[model samples]
Target: MLFFSGKGGVGKSTVTAAMALLAAQQGKRVLVVDVDAKGNLTDLFEHEPVGFKPVEVHPGVHVMTMHTEESLQEYLRLNLRVPVLGRIGPLARALDFVATAAPGVKEILTVGKVCWEVRESIEGRADWDVVLVDAAATGHIVAQLGAPEAIRDLVSVGPVRAQTEWMSDLMHDPAVTALNVVTTPEEMPVNETIELVGRVRSELQVPLGAVIVNRVLPELFTHADEETFEAMRDPAAVNRLVDALGGGPDVARGTTAVLDAARMAVSLRRTRAGHLAELRRAVDLPTLFLPYLFVREHGLRVTRMVAEALGEELGL
Candidate 1:
Protein backbone atom coordinates (compact mmCIF):
# COMPACT_ATOMS: atom_id res chain seq x y z
CA MET A 1 0.00 0.00 0.00
CA LEU A 2 1.28 3.44 -0.98
CA PHE A 3 -0.23 6.72 0.15
CA PHE A 4 0.43 9.80 -2.01
CA SER A 5 0.05 13.18 -0.31
CA GLY A 6 1.18 16.77 -0.58
CA LYS A 7 -0.14 20.30 -0.36
CA GLY A 8 -2.99 21.17 -2.67
CA GLY A 9 -2.08 21.78 -6.34
CA VAL A 10 1.22 19.96 -6.01
CA GLY A 11 -0.09 17.34 -8.49
CA LYS A 12 -0.57 14.64 -5.86
CA SER A 13 -3.49 13.04 -7.65
CA THR A 14 -1.78 13.21 -11.02
CA VAL A 15 1.31 11.49 -9.67
CA THR A 16 -0.78 8.86 -7.94
CA ALA A 17 -2.63 8.12 -11.15
CA ALA A 18 0.62 7.90 -13.08
CA MET A 19 2.08 5.47 -10.57
CA ALA A 20 -1.07 3.37 -10.75
CA LEU A 21 -0.73 3.13 -14.50
CA LEU A 22 2.89 2.14 -14.16
CA ALA A 23 2.02 -0.53 -11.64
CA ALA A 24 -0.68 -1.89 -13.91
CA GLN A 25 1.76 -1.99 -16.79
CA GLN A 26 4.02 -4.11 -14.60
CA GLY A 27 1.21 -6.66 -14.33
CA LYS A 28 0.16 -5.82 -10.79
CA ARG A 29 -3.51 -5.87 -9.95
CA VAL A 30 -3.79 -2.30 -8.69
CA LEU A 31 -6.60 -0.49 -6.95
CA VAL A 32 -6.39 3.29 -6.90
CA VAL A 33 -8.40 4.85 -4.06
CA ASP A 34 -9.25 8.53 -3.98
CA VAL A 35 -9.81 9.88 -0.49
CA ASP A 36 -9.69 13.49 -1.56
CA ALA A 37 -13.06 15.19 -1.89
CA LYS A 38 -12.13 16.58 -5.33
CA GLY A 39 -12.25 13.10 -6.92
CA ASN A 40 -9.83 14.19 -9.64
CA LEU A 41 -8.86 10.58 -10.22
CA THR A 42 -12.33 9.90 -11.66
CA ASP A 43 -11.92 12.81 -14.05
CA LEU A 44 -8.43 11.63 -15.02
CA PHE A 45 -9.78 8.36 -16.34
CA GLU A 46 -13.02 9.84 -17.71
CA HIS A 47 -14.90 7.25 -15.71
CA GLU A 48 -18.45 7.48 -14.55
CA PRO A 49 -19.16 8.62 -10.99
CA VAL A 50 -17.26 6.50 -8.47
CA GLY A 51 -18.80 5.54 -5.16
CA PHE A 52 -17.81 3.01 -2.51
CA LYS A 53 -17.65 0.11 -4.95
CA PRO A 54 -14.51 -0.27 -7.07
CA VAL A 55 -14.85 0.44 -10.76
CA GLU A 56 -12.41 -1.04 -13.25
CA VAL A 57 -11.08 1.82 -15.33
CA HIS A 58 -8.34 -0.04 -17.18
CA PRO A 59 -7.81 -3.77 -17.68
CA GLY A 60 -5.77 -4.14 -14.50
CA VAL A 61 -6.51 -0.86 -12.73
CA HIS A 62 -9.58 -0.32 -10.58
CA VAL A 63 -10.64 3.03 -9.14
CA MET A 64 -12.81 3.93 -6.16
CA THR A 65 -13.85 7.00 -4.22
CA MET A 66 -13.92 6.49 -0.45
CA HIS A 67 -16.68 8.47 1.20
CA THR A 68 -16.26 8.87 4.94
CA GLU A 69 -19.92 8.19 5.72
CA GLU A 70 -20.04 5.10 3.53
CA SER A 71 -16.82 3.87 5.02
CA LEU A 72 -18.27 4.29 8.50
CA GLN A 73 -21.29 2.27 7.50
CA GLU A 74 -19.11 -0.49 6.11
CA TYR A 75 -17.05 -0.51 9.26
CA LEU A 76 -20.16 -0.91 11.38
CA ARG A 77 -21.39 -3.78 9.24
CA LEU A 78 -18.07 -5.57 9.38
CA ASN A 79 -17.47 -5.09 13.10
CA LEU A 80 -20.99 -5.32 14.45
CA ARG A 81 -22.02 -8.06 12.01
CA VAL A 82 -25.29 -6.26 11.53
CA PRO A 83 -25.79 -5.74 7.81
CA VAL A 84 -29.17 -4.03 8.25
CA LEU A 85 -27.65 -1.34 10.52
CA GLY A 86 -25.44 -0.16 7.69
CA ARG A 87 -28.43 0.22 5.37
CA ILE A 88 -30.98 1.54 7.85
CA GLY A 89 -31.55 5.28 7.58
CA PRO A 90 -31.76 6.18 11.26
CA LEU A 91 -28.78 4.03 12.21
CA ALA A 92 -26.69 5.54 9.44
CA ARG A 93 -27.63 9.06 10.47
CA ALA A 94 -26.87 8.33 14.10
CA LEU A 95 -23.48 6.92 13.20
CA ASP A 96 -22.75 9.93 11.06
CA PHE A 97 -23.61 12.22 13.94
CA VAL A 98 -21.26 10.33 16.23
CA ALA A 99 -18.50 10.38 13.65
CA THR A 100 -18.91 14.10 13.22
CA ALA A 101 -18.97 14.80 16.94
CA ALA A 102 -15.89 12.73 17.69
CA PRO A 103 -12.50 13.95 16.58
CA GLY A 104 -10.56 11.47 14.39
CA VAL A 105 -13.44 9.01 14.31
CA LYS A 106 -14.22 9.84 10.72
CA GLU A 107 -10.56 9.71 9.86
CA ILE A 108 -10.26 6.30 11.43
CA LEU A 109 -13.18 5.09 9.39
CA THR A 110 -11.66 6.40 6.17
CA VAL A 111 -8.16 5.13 6.80
CA GLY A 112 -9.39 1.96 8.35
CA LYS A 113 -11.17 1.11 5.14
CA VAL A 114 -7.93 1.58 3.27
CA CYS A 115 -6.02 -0.60 5.74
CA TRP A 116 -8.66 -3.28 5.49
CA GLU A 117 -8.33 -3.37 1.74
CA VAL A 118 -4.59 -3.70 2.03
CA ARG A 119 -4.87 -6.74 4.27
CA GLU A 120 -7.86 -8.27 2.51
CA SER A 121 -7.35 -11.69 1.00
CA ILE A 122 -9.07 -14.54 -0.83
CA GLU A 123 -8.17 -18.16 -0.14
CA GLY A 124 -4.91 -17.09 1.57
CA ARG A 125 -3.82 -14.95 -1.40
CA ALA A 126 -3.91 -11.14 -1.47
CA ASP A 127 -6.89 -9.65 -3.23
CA TRP A 128 -4.79 -7.03 -5.02
CA ASP A 129 -1.12 -6.82 -5.63
CA VAL A 130 -1.01 -3.18 -4.63
CA VAL A 131 -3.19 -0.33 -3.34
CA LEU A 132 -2.52 3.30 -4.25
CA VAL A 133 -4.24 5.97 -2.20
CA ASP A 134 -4.56 9.56 -3.46
CA ALA A 135 -4.84 11.02 -0.01
CA ALA A 136 -5.84 14.50 1.15
CA ALA A 137 -3.48 17.45 1.47
CA THR A 138 -0.64 17.42 3.96
CA GLY A 139 -2.39 18.62 7.09
CA HIS A 140 -5.46 16.47 6.58
CA ILE A 141 -3.44 13.40 5.63
CA VAL A 142 -1.39 13.73 8.80
CA ALA A 143 -4.51 13.92 10.88
CA GLN A 144 -6.10 11.03 9.02
CA LEU A 145 -3.13 8.70 9.27
CA GLY A 146 -2.67 9.61 12.90
CA ALA A 147 -6.26 8.79 13.71
CA PRO A 148 -5.58 5.25 14.79
CA GLU A 149 -3.16 6.36 17.47
CA ALA A 150 -5.44 9.20 18.57
CA ILE A 151 -8.39 6.85 19.01
CA ARG A 152 -6.22 4.28 20.70
CA ASP A 153 -5.33 6.86 23.31
CA LEU A 154 -8.95 7.74 23.88
CA VAL A 155 -10.52 4.30 23.91
CA SER A 156 -8.44 1.98 26.02
CA VAL A 157 -10.46 -1.16 25.56
CA GLY A 158 -13.15 -2.53 23.27
CA PRO A 159 -13.62 -3.14 19.59
CA VAL A 160 -12.72 0.43 18.68
CA ARG A 161 -9.37 0.19 20.38
CA ALA A 162 -8.74 -3.27 19.03
CA GLN A 163 -9.53 -2.21 15.49
CA THR A 164 -7.43 0.93 15.77
CA GLU A 165 -4.49 -1.08 17.09
CA TRP A 166 -4.77 -3.43 14.17
CA MET A 167 -4.84 -0.54 11.73
CA SER A 168 -1.83 1.02 13.40
CA ASP A 169 0.11 -2.19 13.10
CA LEU A 170 -0.61 -2.42 9.40
CA MET A 171 0.23 1.24 8.85
CA HIS A 172 3.54 1.16 10.69
CA ASP A 173 4.60 -2.17 9.30
CA PRO A 174 7.31 -1.41 6.72
CA ALA A 175 6.65 -4.59 4.83
CA VAL A 176 2.98 -3.76 4.22
CA THR A 177 2.89 0.01 3.74
CA ALA A 178 4.89 2.91 2.34
CA LEU A 179 4.31 6.65 1.95
CA ASN A 180 5.30 9.03 -0.83
CA VAL A 181 5.16 12.76 -0.29
CA VAL A 182 4.87 14.89 -3.44
CA THR A 183 5.86 18.53 -3.79
CA THR A 184 6.90 21.14 -6.30
CA PRO A 185 10.28 22.88 -6.16
CA GLU A 186 8.77 25.97 -4.56
CA GLU A 187 9.35 27.66 -1.23
CA MET A 188 6.18 26.92 0.73
CA PRO A 189 5.61 23.47 -0.73
CA VAL A 190 9.19 22.34 -0.14
CA ASN A 191 9.14 23.64 3.40
CA GLU A 192 5.91 21.81 4.08
CA THR A 193 7.34 18.65 2.57
CA ILE A 194 10.33 18.85 4.87
CA GLU A 195 8.17 19.33 7.94
CA LEU A 196 5.90 16.51 6.81
CA VAL A 197 8.85 14.16 6.47
CA GLY A 198 9.97 14.91 10.00
CA ARG A 199 6.52 14.28 11.40
CA VAL A 200 5.95 11.10 9.42
CA ARG A 201 9.25 9.67 10.56
CA SER A 202 9.00 10.78 14.17
CA GLU A 203 5.29 10.90 14.95
CA LEU A 204 3.80 8.28 12.67
CA GLN A 205 6.80 5.94 12.40
CA VAL A 206 5.76 5.00 8.87
CA PRO A 207 8.45 4.12 6.37
CA LEU A 208 8.75 6.64 3.55
CA GLY A 209 9.24 5.26 0.09
CA ALA A 210 10.30 8.43 -1.73
CA VAL A 211 9.83 12.12 -2.23
CA ILE A 212 8.39 12.89 -5.66
CA VAL A 213 9.32 16.33 -6.94
CA ASN A 214 6.84 17.26 -9.64
CA ARG A 215 6.58 19.97 -12.29
CA VAL A 216 10.28 20.92 -12.16
CA LEU A 217 11.36 23.53 -14.67
CA PRO A 218 14.21 22.36 -16.92
CA GLU A 219 17.50 24.28 -16.83
CA LEU A 220 17.43 25.94 -20.22
CA PHE A 221 20.21 28.53 -19.83
CA THR A 222 23.64 27.47 -18.61
CA HIS A 223 26.10 29.86 -17.02
CA ALA A 224 27.92 30.17 -20.38
CA ASP A 225 24.62 30.95 -22.11
CA GLU A 226 23.89 33.62 -19.53
CA GLU A 227 27.31 35.14 -20.06
CA THR A 228 26.72 35.22 -23.80
CA PHE A 229 23.37 36.97 -23.32
CA GLU A 230 24.97 39.40 -20.84
CA ALA A 231 27.60 40.36 -23.43
CA MET A 232 24.82 41.13 -25.95
CA ARG A 233 22.82 43.27 -23.51
CA ASP A 234 24.23 46.57 -24.80
CA PRO A 235 22.00 49.08 -26.61
CA ALA A 236 24.10 48.78 -29.81
CA ALA A 237 23.46 45.03 -30.10
CA VAL A 238 19.78 45.50 -29.30
CA ASN A 239 19.47 48.15 -31.99
CA ARG A 240 21.32 45.94 -34.49
CA LEU A 241 18.97 43.06 -33.88
CA VAL A 242 15.91 45.30 -34.10
CA ASP A 243 17.17 46.89 -37.34
CA ALA A 244 17.89 43.43 -38.76
CA LEU A 245 14.20 42.64 -38.17
CA GLY A 246 13.15 45.85 -40.06
CA GLY A 247 13.42 48.20 -37.02
CA GLY A 248 9.62 48.25 -36.44
CA PRO A 249 7.89 48.38 -33.04
CA ASP A 250 6.80 44.74 -33.57
CA VAL A 251 10.39 43.70 -34.06
CA ALA A 252 11.52 45.40 -30.85
CA ARG A 253 8.56 43.94 -28.96
CA GLY A 254 9.34 40.43 -30.24
CA THR A 255 12.98 40.78 -29.21
CA THR A 256 11.99 41.99 -25.77
CA ALA A 257 9.55 39.07 -25.42
CA VAL A 258 12.22 36.50 -26.23
CA LEU A 259 14.65 38.07 -23.77
CA ASP A 260 12.00 38.22 -21.05
CA ALA A 261 11.10 34.54 -21.60
CA ALA A 262 14.72 33.48 -21.34
CA ARG A 263 15.21 35.53 -18.18
CA MET A 264 12.10 34.06 -16.61
CA ALA A 265 13.21 30.51 -17.47
CA VAL A 266 16.63 31.12 -15.95
CA SER A 267 15.12 32.60 -12.78
CA LEU A 268 12.72 29.70 -12.38
CA ARG A 269 15.48 27.16 -12.92
CA ARG A 270 17.73 28.81 -10.35
CA THR A 271 14.98 28.99 -7.74
CA ARG A 272 14.10 25.34 -8.30
CA ALA A 273 17.72 24.33 -8.00
CA GLY A 274 17.96 25.99 -4.60
CA HIS A 275 14.82 24.24 -3.43
CA LEU A 276 16.07 20.89 -4.75
CA ALA A 277 19.30 21.38 -2.84
CA GLU A 278 17.37 22.07 0.35
CA LEU A 279 15.27 18.96 -0.21
CA ARG A 280 18.39 16.85 -0.66
CA ARG A 281 19.81 18.20 2.59
CA ALA A 282 16.65 17.82 4.71
CA VAL A 283 14.95 14.72 3.33
CA ASP A 284 16.54 11.30 3.81
CA LEU A 285 14.43 9.46 1.23
CA PRO A 286 15.02 8.74 -2.41
CA THR A 287 13.93 11.77 -4.44
CA LEU A 288 12.44 11.44 -7.93
CA PHE A 289 11.99 14.39 -10.25
CA LEU A 290 9.32 14.79 -12.92
CA PRO A 291 9.55 17.59 -15.45
CA TYR A 292 6.71 20.02 -16.01
CA LEU A 293 4.29 18.95 -18.74
CA PHE A 294 3.94 21.61 -21.44
CA VAL A 295 0.78 20.17 -22.90
CA ARG A 296 -2.34 22.28 -23.22
CA GLU A 297 -4.10 20.12 -20.65
CA HIS A 298 -3.49 16.97 -18.62
CA GLY A 299 -5.22 13.86 -19.91
CA LEU A 300 -4.56 10.17 -20.41
CA ARG A 301 -1.78 10.87 -22.90
CA VAL A 302 0.08 13.12 -20.51
CA THR A 303 -0.55 10.71 -17.66
CA ARG A 304 1.00 7.86 -19.65
CA MET A 305 4.02 10.00 -20.46
CA VAL A 306 4.51 10.81 -16.78
CA ALA A 307 4.07 7.15 -15.89
CA GLU A 308 6.72 6.15 -18.43
CA ALA A 309 9.11 8.76 -17.10
CA LEU A 310 8.49 7.67 -13.52
CA GLY A 311 8.96 4.03 -14.45
CA GLU A 312 12.31 4.85 -15.96
CA GLU A 313 13.31 6.75 -12.84
CA LEU A 314 12.41 3.74 -10.70
CA GLY A 315 14.26 1.38 -13.07
CA LEU A 316 11.05 -0.57 -13.65
Candidate 2:
Protein backbone atom coordinates (compact mmCIF):
# COMPACT_ATOMS: atom_id res chain seq x y z
CA MET A 1 0.00 0.00 0.00
CA LEU A 2 1.38 3.39 -1.04
CA PHE A 3 -0.12 6.51 0.55
CA PHE A 4 0.33 9.97 -0.95
CA SER A 5 -0.37 12.42 1.86
CA GLY A 6 0.53 16.01 2.61
CA LYS A 7 -0.98 19.46 3.19
CA GLY A 8 -3.83 20.64 1.00
CA GLY A 9 -3.00 21.73 -2.59
CA VAL A 10 0.34 19.93 -2.54
CA GLY A 11 -0.44 17.80 -5.65
CA LYS A 12 -0.99 14.55 -3.72
CA SER A 13 -3.56 13.52 -6.31
CA THR A 14 -1.12 14.19 -9.13
CA VAL A 15 1.56 12.09 -7.49
CA THR A 16 -0.88 9.29 -6.72
CA ALA A 17 -2.13 9.14 -10.30
CA ALA A 18 1.38 9.14 -11.73
CA MET A 19 2.50 6.36 -9.40
CA ALA A 20 -0.58 4.26 -10.17
CA LEU A 21 -0.23 4.74 -13.92
CA LEU A 22 3.44 3.84 -13.77
CA ALA A 23 2.71 0.81 -11.65
CA ALA A 24 0.13 -0.34 -14.16
CA GLN A 25 2.58 0.18 -17.00
CA GLN A 26 5.01 -2.04 -15.14
CA GLY A 27 2.42 -4.88 -15.33
CA LYS A 28 1.14 -4.32 -11.79
CA ARG A 29 -2.61 -3.94 -11.58
CA VAL A 30 -3.25 -0.74 -9.64
CA LEU A 31 -6.19 0.87 -7.91
CA VAL A 32 -6.06 4.58 -7.11
CA VAL A 33 -8.29 5.44 -4.15
CA ASP A 34 -9.69 8.92 -3.86
CA VAL A 35 -10.07 9.34 -0.12
CA ASP A 36 -10.08 13.10 -0.06
CA ALA A 37 -13.42 14.84 0.35
CA LYS A 38 -12.73 16.96 -2.73
CA GLY A 39 -12.42 13.90 -4.98
CA ASN A 40 -9.32 15.29 -6.60
CA LEU A 41 -8.09 11.92 -7.83
CA THR A 42 -11.16 11.49 -9.99
CA ASP A 43 -10.29 14.71 -11.75
CA LEU A 44 -6.85 13.37 -12.57
CA PHE A 45 -8.28 10.39 -14.40
CA GLU A 46 -10.42 10.71 -17.54
CA HIS A 47 -13.42 8.82 -16.17
CA GLU A 48 -15.73 9.49 -13.26
CA PRO A 49 -15.85 7.01 -10.38
CA VAL A 50 -18.90 6.59 -8.19
CA GLY A 51 -18.52 6.45 -4.45
CA PHE A 52 -17.85 3.08 -2.78
CA LYS A 53 -17.62 1.23 -6.11
CA PRO A 54 -14.52 0.67 -8.17
CA VAL A 55 -14.62 1.97 -11.72
CA GLU A 56 -12.06 1.31 -14.43
CA VAL A 57 -10.84 4.77 -15.26
CA HIS A 58 -8.10 3.38 -17.47
CA PRO A 59 -6.75 0.05 -18.58
CA GLY A 60 -5.39 -1.72 -15.51
CA VAL A 61 -6.33 1.29 -13.41
CA HIS A 62 -9.40 1.23 -11.12
CA VAL A 63 -10.65 4.29 -9.27
CA MET A 64 -12.94 4.67 -6.27
CA THR A 65 -14.25 7.63 -4.27
CA MET A 66 -14.51 7.38 -0.50
CA HIS A 67 -17.18 9.59 1.02
CA THR A 68 -17.64 9.72 4.76
CA GLU A 69 -21.42 9.77 4.60
CA GLU A 70 -21.63 6.89 2.13
CA SER A 71 -19.26 4.79 4.24
CA LEU A 72 -21.24 5.56 7.37
CA GLN A 73 -24.53 4.56 5.78
CA GLU A 74 -23.04 1.38 4.35
CA TYR A 75 -21.53 0.43 7.70
CA LEU A 76 -24.70 1.11 9.66
CA ARG A 77 -27.02 -0.72 7.30
CA LEU A 78 -24.86 -3.66 6.23
CA ASN A 79 -22.43 -4.32 9.05
CA LEU A 80 -24.19 -2.94 12.09
CA ARG A 81 -27.68 -3.83 10.75
CA VAL A 82 -29.09 -0.83 12.60
CA PRO A 83 -32.51 -0.03 11.28
CA VAL A 84 -32.84 3.57 10.35
CA LEU A 85 -34.78 5.93 12.62
CA GLY A 86 -36.58 7.41 9.62
CA ARG A 87 -36.64 7.53 5.80
CA ILE A 88 -33.73 8.48 3.50
CA GLY A 89 -34.11 12.20 4.17
CA PRO A 90 -34.07 11.71 7.91
CA LEU A 91 -31.33 9.11 7.57
CA ALA A 92 -29.13 11.80 6.10
CA ARG A 93 -29.83 13.98 9.11
CA ALA A 94 -29.04 11.16 11.50
CA LEU A 95 -25.85 10.39 9.64
CA ASP A 96 -24.91 14.04 9.78
CA PHE A 97 -25.44 13.91 13.53
CA VAL A 98 -23.25 10.85 13.90
CA ALA A 99 -20.64 12.32 11.61
CA THR A 100 -20.29 15.45 13.70
CA ALA A 101 -21.36 14.44 17.19
CA ALA A 102 -19.53 11.13 17.56
CA PRO A 103 -16.15 12.63 16.74
CA GLY A 104 -14.02 10.43 14.47
CA VAL A 105 -16.96 8.20 13.56
CA LYS A 106 -16.93 9.46 9.99
CA GLU A 107 -13.18 9.07 9.89
CA ILE A 108 -13.46 5.50 11.08
CA LEU A 109 -16.09 4.66 8.51
CA THR A 110 -14.01 6.15 5.70
CA VAL A 111 -10.90 4.35 6.85
CA GLY A 112 -12.83 1.12 7.23
CA LYS A 113 -13.76 1.29 3.58
CA VAL A 114 -10.08 1.66 2.67
CA CYS A 115 -9.22 -1.26 4.95
CA TRP A 116 -11.74 -3.39 3.11
CA GLU A 117 -10.14 -2.51 -0.19
CA VAL A 118 -6.69 -3.37 1.11
CA ARG A 119 -7.85 -6.72 2.41
CA GLU A 120 -9.58 -7.48 -0.86
CA SER A 121 -6.44 -6.57 -2.80
CA ILE A 122 -4.40 -8.93 -0.68
CA GLU A 123 -6.86 -11.77 -1.32
CA GLY A 124 -6.10 -11.75 -5.09
CA ARG A 125 -9.79 -11.48 -5.83
CA ALA A 126 -9.25 -7.97 -7.17
CA ASP A 127 -7.06 -7.29 -10.18
CA TRP A 128 -4.80 -4.88 -8.41
CA ASP A 129 -1.10 -5.19 -7.71
CA VAL A 130 -1.19 -2.19 -5.36
CA VAL A 131 -3.61 0.20 -3.70
CA LEU A 132 -2.67 3.89 -4.00
CA VAL A 133 -4.49 6.10 -1.54
CA ASP A 134 -4.65 9.82 -2.26
CA ALA A 135 -5.24 10.55 1.39
CA ALA A 136 -6.45 13.74 3.02
CA ALA A 137 -4.22 16.71 3.75
CA THR A 138 -2.10 17.07 6.85
CA GLY A 139 -4.85 18.74 8.87
CA HIS A 140 -6.95 15.57 9.11
CA ILE A 141 -4.44 12.82 8.24
CA VAL A 142 -3.67 11.96 11.87
CA ALA A 143 -7.30 11.41 12.79
CA GLN A 144 -7.83 9.43 9.61
CA LEU A 145 -4.92 7.11 10.36
CA GLY A 146 -6.00 6.68 13.99
CA ALA A 147 -9.59 5.84 13.06
CA PRO A 148 -9.11 2.08 13.26
CA GLU A 149 -7.48 2.35 16.63
CA ALA A 150 -10.30 4.58 17.86
CA ILE A 151 -12.93 2.07 16.77
CA ARG A 152 -10.95 -0.79 18.26
CA ASP A 153 -10.73 0.97 21.61
CA LEU A 154 -14.40 1.94 21.64
CA VAL A 155 -15.80 -1.56 20.96
CA SER A 156 -13.51 -4.08 22.58
CA VAL A 157 -15.75 -7.16 22.68
CA GLY A 158 -17.46 -7.56 19.34
CA PRO A 159 -16.89 -8.39 15.69
CA VAL A 160 -16.46 -4.68 14.94
CA ARG A 161 -13.68 -4.55 17.52
CA ALA A 162 -11.96 -7.51 15.93
CA GLN A 163 -12.17 -5.98 12.48
CA THR A 164 -10.95 -2.63 13.70
CA GLU A 165 -8.02 -4.25 15.45
CA TRP A 166 -7.03 -6.01 12.24
CA MET A 167 -7.20 -2.79 10.29
CA SER A 168 -5.15 -0.99 12.92
CA ASP A 169 -2.53 -3.68 12.72
CA LEU A 170 -2.40 -3.30 8.95
CA MET A 171 -1.86 0.42 9.31
CA HIS A 172 0.94 0.05 11.84
CA ASP A 173 2.67 -2.69 9.91
CA PRO A 174 5.69 -1.22 8.16
CA ALA A 175 6.16 -4.10 5.78
CA VAL A 176 2.71 -3.65 4.24
CA THR A 177 2.32 0.12 4.31
CA ALA A 178 4.47 3.12 3.40
CA LEU A 179 3.73 6.83 3.75
CA ASN A 180 5.21 9.46 1.38
CA VAL A 181 4.94 13.10 2.25
CA VAL A 182 4.75 15.54 -0.70
CA THR A 183 6.07 19.06 -0.34
CA THR A 184 7.30 22.05 -2.32
CA PRO A 185 10.44 24.17 -2.05
CA GLU A 186 8.71 26.99 -0.16
CA GLU A 187 9.07 27.88 3.49
CA MET A 188 5.60 26.89 4.67
CA PRO A 189 5.60 23.57 2.84
CA VAL A 190 9.14 22.64 3.92
CA ASN A 191 8.37 23.46 7.55
CA GLU A 192 5.17 21.45 7.44
CA THR A 193 6.99 18.56 5.77
CA ILE A 194 9.61 18.43 8.50
CA GLU A 195 6.98 18.50 11.22
CA LEU A 196 4.92 15.82 9.44
CA VAL A 197 7.93 13.50 9.06
CA GLY A 198 8.63 13.76 12.78
CA ARG A 199 4.99 13.14 13.65
CA VAL A 200 4.72 10.08 11.43
CA ARG A 201 7.86 8.63 13.00
CA SER A 202 6.92 9.47 16.60
CA GLU A 203 3.18 8.79 16.33
CA LEU A 204 2.49 6.32 13.55
CA GLN A 205 5.91 4.62 13.72
CA VAL A 206 5.53 3.99 10.00
CA PRO A 207 8.50 4.20 7.70
CA LEU A 208 8.91 7.56 5.97
CA GLY A 209 9.44 6.60 2.40
CA ALA A 210 10.65 9.82 0.73
CA VAL A 211 10.08 13.56 0.54
CA ILE A 212 8.77 14.33 -2.97
CA VAL A 213 9.80 17.89 -3.87
CA ASN A 214 7.48 19.04 -6.61
CA ARG A 215 7.89 21.88 -9.11
CA VAL A 216 11.65 22.26 -8.61
CA LEU A 217 13.32 24.69 -10.98
CA PRO A 218 16.19 23.46 -13.08
CA GLU A 219 19.67 24.95 -12.65
CA LEU A 220 20.26 26.71 -15.95
CA PHE A 221 23.59 28.31 -15.13
CA THR A 222 26.90 26.43 -15.29
CA HIS A 223 30.08 27.56 -13.48
CA ALA A 224 31.12 29.59 -16.51
CA ASP A 225 27.68 31.19 -16.74
CA GLU A 226 27.83 32.06 -13.03
CA GLU A 227 31.18 33.77 -13.55
CA THR A 228 29.78 35.68 -16.52
CA PHE A 229 26.71 36.74 -14.51
CA GLU A 230 28.92 37.96 -11.67
CA ALA A 231 31.23 39.85 -14.02
CA MET A 232 28.29 41.51 -15.76
CA ARG A 233 27.14 43.00 -12.44
CA ASP A 234 30.41 44.82 -11.77
CA PRO A 235 30.35 48.65 -11.97
CA ALA A 236 33.29 48.62 -14.39
CA ALA A 237 31.27 46.27 -16.63
CA VAL A 238 28.33 48.70 -16.55
CA ASN A 239 30.70 51.54 -17.53
CA ARG A 240 31.97 49.47 -20.45
CA LEU A 241 28.42 48.78 -21.57
CA VAL A 242 27.66 52.55 -21.43
CA ASP A 243 30.70 53.20 -23.62
CA ALA A 244 29.81 50.41 -26.04
CA LEU A 245 26.15 51.42 -26.35
CA GLY A 246 26.92 55.21 -26.64
CA GLY A 247 23.82 55.89 -24.51
CA GLY A 248 24.67 59.49 -23.67
CA PRO A 249 25.75 58.93 -20.00
CA ASP A 250 22.59 57.02 -19.00
CA VAL A 251 24.07 54.44 -16.59
CA ALA A 252 20.66 53.13 -15.41
CA ARG A 253 19.58 52.25 -18.95
CA GLY A 254 22.96 50.71 -19.73
CA THR A 255 22.98 48.71 -16.49
CA THR A 256 19.34 47.66 -16.97
CA ALA A 257 20.07 46.54 -20.51
CA VAL A 258 22.86 44.27 -19.25
CA LEU A 259 20.71 42.91 -16.39
CA ASP A 260 17.78 41.43 -18.27
CA ALA A 261 15.08 39.01 -17.06
CA ALA A 262 17.56 36.11 -17.20
CA ARG A 263 19.25 37.54 -14.10
CA MET A 264 16.01 37.34 -12.10
CA ALA A 265 15.37 33.83 -13.34
CA VAL A 266 18.87 32.80 -12.34
CA SER A 267 18.43 34.36 -8.89
CA LEU A 268 15.07 32.65 -8.36
CA ARG A 269 16.54 29.32 -9.40
CA ARG A 270 19.32 29.63 -6.84
CA THR A 271 16.87 30.59 -4.11
CA ARG A 272 14.68 27.58 -4.87
CA ALA A 273 17.71 25.26 -4.88
CA GLY A 274 18.77 26.65 -1.52
CA HIS A 275 15.35 25.95 -0.05
CA LEU A 276 15.40 22.40 -1.41
CA ALA A 277 18.85 21.76 0.04
CA GLU A 278 17.78 23.08 3.43
CA LEU A 279 14.72 20.81 3.44
CA ARG A 280 16.85 17.83 2.41
CA ARG A 281 19.25 18.42 5.31
CA ALA A 282 16.48 18.95 7.83
CA VAL A 283 14.42 15.87 6.95
CA ASP A 284 17.27 13.44 6.24
CA LEU A 285 15.03 11.46 3.90
CA PRO A 286 15.58 10.48 0.27
CA THR A 287 14.36 13.58 -1.54
CA LEU A 288 12.99 13.14 -5.05
CA PHE A 289 13.06 16.33 -7.07
CA LEU A 290 10.52 16.86 -9.86
CA PRO A 291 11.09 19.59 -12.42
CA TYR A 292 8.86 22.62 -12.63
CA LEU A 293 6.07 21.88 -15.07
CA PHE A 294 5.29 24.81 -17.33
CA VAL A 295 2.06 23.41 -18.65
CA ARG A 296 -1.07 25.52 -18.74
CA GLU A 297 -3.11 22.65 -17.25
CA HIS A 298 -2.33 19.34 -15.58
CA GLY A 299 -3.22 16.20 -17.50
CA LEU A 300 -1.65 12.95 -18.65
CA ARG A 301 1.41 14.84 -19.81
CA VAL A 302 2.18 16.08 -16.32
CA THR A 303 1.29 12.67 -14.95
CA ARG A 304 3.80 11.04 -17.28
CA MET A 305 6.48 13.46 -16.22
CA VAL A 306 5.79 12.63 -12.61
CA ALA A 307 6.04 8.93 -13.39
CA GLU A 308 9.39 9.41 -15.08
CA ALA A 309 10.67 11.33 -12.08
CA LEU A 310 9.51 8.59 -9.74
CA GLY A 311 11.16 5.96 -11.90
CA GLU A 312 14.45 7.82 -11.84
CA GLU A 313 14.25 8.35 -8.08
CA LEU A 314 13.26 4.76 -7.29
CA GLY A 315 15.73 3.38 -9.89
CA LEU A 316 13.05 1.14 -11.33
lDDT of 2 at 19: 87
TM-score of 2: 0.85
In terms of lDDT, model 1 sits at 0.85
User: What tens-digit string does per-residue lDDT give for candidate 2 at 218-282?
Assistant: 78789898899879778898667777777575766756765876687788888877777778788
Alpha carbon lDDT at 245, candidate 1: 81
Question: How much is the lDDT of residue 130 in candidate 1?
Answer: 89
TM-score of each: 0.93, 0.85
Model 2 clashing residue pairs (backbone) = 29-129
> lDDT at 291 for candidate 1?
90
Candidate 2 ranges beyond 4 A from true positions: 48-50, 76-89, 233-259
Best by TM-score: 1
For each candidate in the order shown, give its overall lDDT on alpha carbons. 0.85, 0.77
When summed lDDT is taken over every stretch of 10 residues in candidate 2, the lowest stretch is 42-51
Give the best candidate by lDDT. 1
lDDT tens digits by residue: candidate 1, 5-116: 9999999988998999999999988999899868678667666667888989877889989887778767777788767743567866787898777778888988898888
